[model samples]
Target: MRTRFRARPRKWGPLRGLLAAAAVGVLVFPAGASAVSAAPLAEQDLGSRLAADYEAAFLTQYNKIKDPANGYFRQFGDLLVPYHSVETLIVEAPDHGHETTSEAFSYYLWLEATYGQITGNWEPFNKAWRSMETYIIPAQKDQPTNSGYNPAKPATYAAEHGDPSGYPSRLDSGVSVGQDPIANELSSTYGTNNIYGMHWLLDVDNVYGYGFCGDGSKNAPAYINTFQRGEQESVWETVTHPSCETFKFGGKNGFLDLFTGDSSYSKQWRYTNAPDADARAVQVAYWAKTWADKQGKGSQISSAVANAAKMGDYLRYSMYDKYFKKIGNCTSPSCPAGSGKNSAHYLLGWYYSWGGADASAQYPWAFRIGSSAPHQGYQNPLAAWALANDPQLKPKSATGATDWATSLNRQLEFLQWLQSAEGGIAGGASNSWGGSYGTPPANSPKFYGMAYDYQPVWHDPPSNRWFGFQTWGMERVAQYYYVTKDSRAKSILDKWVPWAINNTTVGTGGSFAIPADLQWSGQPNNWTGNPSTNTNLHVSVLNKNNDVGIAASLAKTLLYYAAGSGNTQARTTGEKLLDALLGNTDSKGIAVPETRADYNRFDDTYSQGGLYVPNGWTGKMANGDTINSSSTFLSIRSFYKQDPDWSKVQSYLNGGAVPTFTYHRFWSQAEIATAFAVHAELF
Candidate 1:
């Protein structure tokens, strides 16, 4: 997802006052680690000048990021959970900055992995995983009824609508769904039916009062969710609810009636996993293993590596259809149900979800994969390769490694199929049109019988509109090419890198601009052994801005491509962009001021991108805010007005000019650190 935001600058809340205690050395230890310090930067002399400079840069950013005084993380008892941003007033993919995501946790892993590479200390990397396992991944106690899941009857069918107005979509049990191919195998291998993957979202501070398993105990890091309606449901238009619904808040059935039309609602727990974030965790673990092995400290990170492998095992759920319907050309509900692996698409879809009734209930649990494999941004060939080829990372399940091996090649081919004539990759393909196996427009481009969609999953601002997806996806491709010297990957980057470089500008005094919003025309040709380029398929840079996170990510992609291909221009551009980034460094981390014109949309109604509660349907948030047919985004979320930055947005809502703010997002800061570390390690 794009790390864009809208807000005016505001000071952070109270700092933790622990910075001075951990500032004694160059290496910053995580909270709960030993109080000892490493050697001073002046004393440790790396032989190479480039190594020393980049290492120092990495350390500078790393210290600010991990400093409790900066507020990037909150230490709950012994666990450290990273926030989406240091500022609580922010809204992007998450409604509040304090809310954490699996994406943030993955970047946390990357930050510590780079630290281990630079300082020969692997404990921090291991510690990060331990924290992720404890807080984000739902525990057995959290998912108490998984033992009742039935592979034969995975889930009843529910047609997804296009917008919030079309929600509470009726569940139709008349449609036939396929059997789950991997559930039995996974349960047998792990000796448990519980899922091991991390849930995508968490209310880290329990800001919404969705306490532990919906018991309302004020527990921090509670499971919560938003964006269940449809593609038209943007962050501003979502109604937040507890993942474990217990009628503690909202209407008679909690928030269930708002999204699904069921005869009766059950008190249950559910979770949605973002596949990209989980793949990214495995990708970082691979790098940690590679770097530690070179230092003879591989054993220090062996446990974390094995856990990453296990996560990959469960992550395979993303490769199947939502109801496990047979893939390709199924335009009606009468389409044949898949028997085994026929439903497997072998590509990473948007999400995979699971849920079940409360512990005392006797109903069976349900699981579902996704049908839309949108943006190439989600693919992680390197992670797939590691799971299939690396002995330490190969999954324990009998067919897990084999499944990932197939996914690796299929993912690469997908990249080749979607690459445009102008070099940028186009949007992805969907098996179920309109999210219900509906018919597509005549002559629609196809990939393995799935129709191409320029904006696949979400559609409010359009999923493929942001250029960050280009950089994010290509970075993985560049890494794959760098590691394997695979000519296929190089060919794809050969076209994409120059197109990106042509659009990017890095200048003096940290003034730089990279493609921000993108506009696309036409579509890629249908897939073939030798897929022909659709000359009609094209992409244009609609706008540009200096998003520090995207710039750092772009630099990583370019540097990796340059190191592998030995291209002089790519190396020069990457180095220049990275040098430009250091000019913007601040006390918290590197950042640039952003004008959040979109903040005006905060109070918008359904017609204007705000919350749309159905008519005559009434509910109440835990804070007792009334939810009704006329509720605006701000109406139910009265908490936003309590934010310190609310005045700026309030003034803007009152017809003032848009407010501007410099955001210190956790993932961006970690990316800045890792960019420097990668440069030091490679060159």
Candidate 2:
């Protein structure tokens, strides 16, 4: 289900044109040029000042890209339009095909609503809401009227029948008229699309009273009810997906784990019912119930509480396992149909076998179907967050809250257990599934020219080896500490933060010190020949440079830890790291030399002009050319304006005009808008 697109070197033809256009009055500021002043604001007024700047910038870009008929923004801006056809509007020409994802739009909706709350600007919120109701929500509810078209069935329907297209198919330009759009929209099918979108809606409503859904009126309640119905329908479809029924685990008849059948990453649709997706769904359902209760519409979400509890039980009892064991031995009154064999057909079997022989020694990482290795950085924290928030998920005991606290404590302890003596946390154990630079084994499950096996347990040996860019775990631990004042969590952060600061070297220099994949056994010697020198597995080594994503994540964690422990030095260092990242900019004030180019697969010219935060400096490509990482501008936007330099970056985005730069379709726009909306007071 993964889509593989090769990156090719891009010429500066388009970029030069953009710059030339900007030189003229082609892209003047939509908002007045005076929105952002040259002088920086005082630290106390930084949040509000930056909020103004961000709002201006968002409007400029939004106006340019928004569809006139429908409020949704197109995928690519004017820069690359000629290179691609109207049908493949969002596709980065000649690479991956055209497709739009709900997550991007979901993020946009959340951003607009959040910013509106922060600034009391309802214009953006109205626009975003209108787009959602007009296009996205209607698309999910679209289905055939025939009796064969069961709303509860776990099957996909055509986008043609759906109102307002289900996916981003063509540009609104006249040249692409009358062409039918093609999309394999899974989120809409599985209910995730609605659930995720509703989660944000609930968040905005909770923060800024009811009736904020396009001003106070009965329309808000009506829309919520419609969304709730869609969400409920989608969840039913998910639990009934053939895979869920076929592969029942831990006595749960309708327990489900599946991904939206979207084609993007190499791993898409390969597994079903991912723990992260389920946990998120649980939160969405919980929030839905809470929102309904607050509005005196309790009947609207009467079943939501029970649904969330069921999902939570699945996560805790069925999915959460301390050790890998046969599905039959996994739980009391073990799964009757459990088989002790490994095959793709036997989902549980594959999971248990992949657990490796040393399961007894390992701490429980959240279990994902088709694999036993814990996704420590990605899945674990989300599960913790969901479990901590929902009281219905807690055991029915006098000390139910205590049990929740204990669960979080244990999860933190597992993270601490994985921390190296040198203070770096090992990214969870590597799954036996193989996409190694080396050859595959005979029994390997062949997919995408890689092997998938369940043998040879892999864990980072106690050393300085750390997973590349695995800072989310630290962020979650810090967040837990901030909320609960847990001493263990604080202690872990106290030790790890100083160690990370020391280990992280700044500047583009001699050897790329950040190992993309650090291994202990050193079996995969494909990275650097000098793996023996470091006593850690060196999967891939990028040249020494500032990694925006890692830097931002680490800085955020440091900020959280500092807030909780009153550690002034940690706060100072965190701000310093952010300053360094914000400083990695070109003359035009765009963050330069992208480190994570793999993110935006379409534009092959890795280190081109864009507002991308580089993965690291001196990042070496496969062709022996050292280039900047790709732009994850949106992801980095949340940390915007932390320093004076960022104000200039915001100015460029607001309407300073750089024609050569291409606007990413959904993700970038949403992230940038969200980043601008971030309230400075929180920091």
Candidate 3:
């Protein structure tokens, strides 16, 4: 059974000191007019309107259910519940029971900090900060205080009883700061101890390190220590375990276990140290140490630097060469011994599923190495960002060493290598094993899968099949270019961005007809002579569908690239796309034709009216899919100044009643608040 953390609705609790910090005095601007003469009303005045509305909404809702003990705004019977969850139109009032994750809350914290920085008012920030310190952080640390293992108990008893140490291994999800350790734990099948919780702590530290701590915040140190303690506990768990201690490779003394389980739950490979997880852990530790070092407070984060180095060593020596092999007609010496047509550059299997060796044969066919899955496009860039940010993780030698930056470049190169002459990058690549997972003929280089839901499916693969969300990878690449000014990254964006813009469909009134995605597929080498020869398998749209999230994402990437590359056309096209997105909104600030949908499921029952922005319009596909409005908001916030309809958007969002949406209410509200805060330039 898939154990999900479900939240239950609870009555609004009493407010003690929460009411005293309500956002004071609304800053109203001229209605329906631009506050700045040169800017549109949507751009200049929209932010103020959003600010006022958000403040009002936050105070009104917060006062109703502020937990007196911790000042956390609790609703839906969960602690630290974001205000957006309450305003969703899908679940209705008094029953807003959406589950919140550590990842989502991390985004919320960023929004809060950014909102506070952009807007002069820090009341909301203060509230969120207090809640995180007093409630959220404490909840994350809630676990067994004593060491979970007992020598007298049977070896299997450790698994049954679980880790008793009150370390920060628990990645809490749902309402409130703390919940049942076993129930709230993520990746439980692979042992409750994982790096996700430590990742969350890193996020908290980042929020403070970014600038919140410099402002004389009182609780920043405590939060930092909490994260450090968690990291220490994780290290202790790994070293103390007999299984982990006994595992060895090349005469090495230590083994970094990635996940805690075996192959039973399709996690056979995750039990060993994973490159991705190790990379993240290294980055977190590096950043924590950097923060501590900068503050002239080295003692507070003593173990951070050493911990990061240890993880970095594991990634560099153990995981990199063991799992990651070069491929795709490479002439370079770095390619593995068996590099050729069958060999492809790919991250073996999401992570080293098991320790010490490449165990590719045990899993599903499509998940093995050489697949070059599109999901890696997203993860690789993040890993790159972490490595690029820290010097310790850089390559130690000038030759034959692949550091995080080199890894990022290789990943980017692989994506470009997969691109067809038509400019559409293959969402996935499969070798001869494709037939094992339902592909015809089970031959090598079979392009017979649809790219959706971040998974490559073998169905009627569209010639121009591409995942909309994967375009965000371009943004990461652009960010890399901004930092390193790498010409290769620039060249990739230059080629892909133009192709993306040309394929996008816009209506007469500036509304997007089809969302931003690739519109052409490459020719199949074996099954057909060329793409034109296979009309039966070819899939094309009539320029009537719009993926709002993808559209927003593409526009944001364009804006970022334009800023770096000074590409006037990219900037212009990006602004126009954002304007088209704004055109979808009604006078009340709610996006219309909102639908509740996912990759495999579509439901348009709640399409008529909602408070938050809909994911995207159900166009020709009519899949009833809409993403979280917060995503759209974040994308828009990226280039609000360039958008021509800024004032109108601001007015719509600021019209006062909180906008509603079908799902992910907490994310939507937090994003809306973030957009408004960003516009206000509080950060």
- Residues 1-683 of candidate 2 have per-residue lDDT tens digits of 01111111121111111122123223232222223321222333211245443344333333333433222333222211111111221212121112222233344544444444433443443454444434333222221111122112212211110111122112111111111010012223233322112211111111111122212222211111101111011110111111112122111211111212223211011112223334434433443444445546445344444544444443331122212122211112121221222111111111110100111223211112223234344334434544556555442323323434444544564455444445555433322222111234443322212122212212111112233234545765676677668777777777678766665654421111222333333222122212112233222222234334345556666777777888877666554554443343222221234322222322222233222212332222111222333423222122222432344344445555321222233433343333332213235
lDDT of 1 at 331: 80
Query: Best by lDDT, which number?
Result: 1
- Candidate 2 accuracy as lDDT: 0.32
Better of 1 and 2 by lDDT: 1
Q: Candidate 3: where are CA atoms >4 Å away? A: 1-97, 101-106, 109-113, 116-377, 380-385, 392-403, 430-467, 505-510, 516-520, 523-547, 582-590, 595-683
Score each candidate by Cα lDDT.
Answer: 0.83, 0.32, 0.32
Return whichever of 1 and 3 wins on TM-score.
1
Show model 1 residue runs off by greater than 4 Å: 1-49
Residue 257 CA displacement from its true place in model 2, Å: 22
Residue-level lDDT tens digits of model 3 in 508-583: 3435654322344433343222222222222233333454445555655666677678887776666555445445
* Cα error of candidate 2 at position 338, Å: 6.1
Estimate the TM-score of every prediction.
Answer: 0.94, 0.43, 0.45
Q: What is the C-alpha lDDT profile of model 1 across 568-589, one tens digit per residue?
A: 7887788777777877867788
